[model samples]
Target: MKTDLNQLEPQALVDAFLKYPPAGFQVHEPDNFLAFFYTRFNLLTTLDVALHQKIKALPGYRHWQNMLHLQTCFVGTTVTEYTLLSAQLSAQQMTEFLKQHIQKTRLTIIKDLPLNSPFISEMENNYSQELIKSAEKNGFLSVEGQALAYVPIDFENREDYLSRLSKSRRKNLKRKLKSLNEIDVEILATGHAKFQDAEFTAQLYRLYLNVYHQSEIHFDLLSPAFFQAILQDGDSGGTVLFYWVGTALAGFNLCYEYRGNLVDKYIGFNYPLATDHNLYFISWFVNLEYARVRGMKFYIAGWTDPEVKAQLGAEFTFTRHLVWIRSPVLRFILTRLRSVFEADHHWHQQQELKS
Candidate 1:
């Protein structure tokens, strides 16, 4: 069930990152076998908002924050659906790679490495866990991050799916679905002629930025080129749905169909209009309906807004990050304060109780 990155031609890896590197990162071509990008990293990105504000209220918080700013190299692309690593790379080899790379940069992070993936082999999952253990053994900071939410499409219809949720939740979702009557829904695929238009592509890019800038946690500003690439790649199995209210674009979701799953990826919204129309809840069900009609076995709802996703009947699987701080003192400090980064895990637990 594991996907092999080695199955991709080496040139494809080079082209993929070079064309659509994470925004503001300087892409490095160290070798054809690996993807690397460097950027300034803020240590507080993963902390819970309330905890972050509390930390900010502490004396000399600005000085502490300034000290935490790091010039870091990330071993994998954050924008990708999953972390891409060469199959041949071992835990020791990755540790050595990070050890060497961190010498140039203040920190080296292997972000979003899957602790356990349904699409990964037992060997690969073990490799990821071992890599985290090895990193921790080498005095690196290993942080278990968040869950990538998903819904297994096991029902006969939308009503059957809703019946599985709590009575109140099902009623609330049904109320939100009323907005669908006012919105015009259009679904487009990657090869659509509209994606070829320069102005239309730019418009979609701006919408993506609208959502990105409004997000609570800001990381990995995807480039316009990335959107254009996915829009135009007919073979990528990409599907985009646009929600329209009269002549205006209310929102859009860019997703993909792959291996019996509808992978919900990027989304963009035209703010007040989207909120006024309850577009979030509307789109959530729309996606579920899409996958259900297609007979897909799962809807991979992506890695944001876990609380909201949980309310919408999504189940989750989590991932971990291995962060190697170059300074021994900083590593020691982070080791003591690692619980600050476990906010998402805590939220996941709360969701379990509500369920």
Candidate 2:
């Protein structure tokens, strides 16, 4: 039965998120085992300047500007994710269900399916090929989305991890850390001493907006309440580490612990000072150190900015989405126009040279 997330117990929150999320989600529960819905008004902009301009000039481009995307509540930039509670149903049965029920809905664009994800392993024995075949059979247009960066936390200590980096890169990181000696860093678990400060919460929101507005692609604009809810929701496994220069809050990172993985979810920073102190790099090391000490197997450093992450020795994982259009005309147009929406492979290849 479908139920309000608020009414559920705190421990049930994580399982609900993993198996059937409801908080901040607009879902369609087909059965107790299956649910589907999409977040609306997701701006489909991109960092590719030339491609963005080209797409904007095309006829009927406005229709493609905004999208209805699959719900990504707690997964950061994960684009699209779904939970299937039972293994009794065959893949054909599930696909037919989607076609019969979901295909009639206005939510046509399903996205951000991690090609490497093990969650739906039963449905697609071979991740890439099986997914492509299934999506094609269902009249869905499959396309490659952005690649996510992740750091394998296999090292015993900070130095062990740094040893794998290039000598120059390692030296640069050391220099940045040395320059920021005066700054104090604190990692606060949910309900920690400084976690509930209203003023700090407001500042974090402001800094997040500053970064959001500057980005080329604008999709999900997380609200201030979303920031506070995670921290205060005790069972959310959320934590925020604040970097302070005395009383001033320079930067903060909101992360979560999920199934032995440390996901670096969101980050907010005070402008000029953030750059002056090289807080981005500092936060990178700090998060890594935290993961190492916590004995996490992997540190997932969210999506976008493939270049800098590659320089930091972070490996890349590709994500694909199955876009099903309800209108025949629009489907034809979009099928012919998939290249514009696909990730810029050229830029990623260029970034690879840095590593």
lDDT per model vs. reference: 0.79, 0.63
State the displacement of the C-alpha of residue 18, model 2, in Å, after optimal TM-score superposition. 12
Give lDDT tens digits, candidate 1, residues 1-355.
Answer: 1235412112332355578787778876565346678888888888998987888899988777776678888876665555567656777777776676578677887777776776456776777788888888876777877788889888888899899999999999899888999999999988799999989989888888989998878878888787787787777777999999999999999887876788887899998999999999999989999999988878988888888998898888888888877778887888898888888888888767875
Stretches of candidate 2 above 4 Å error? 1-35, 38-47, 53-89, 117-131, 344-346, 349-355
- Kindly list the per-residue Cα lDDT of model 2 for residues 1-355, writing each as its tens digit: 3322111123333343434433355545444434444554342453366766776788987785554343221111222222222344444654565567554554454455446553224334244445456768878777776766778888888788889999999998888887469689987887664658888678788988877777777765666665666556666677788888888888888777766777777788888888788998889888988888888877878776777887788887666666666668767876887776665455666666754
Best-fitting candidate, scored by lDDT: 1
Model 1: residues with Cα > 4 Å off, grouped in runs = 1-17, 57-64, 353-355
For model 2 the TM-score comes to 0.78
How many clashing pairs does model 1 include?
A: 0
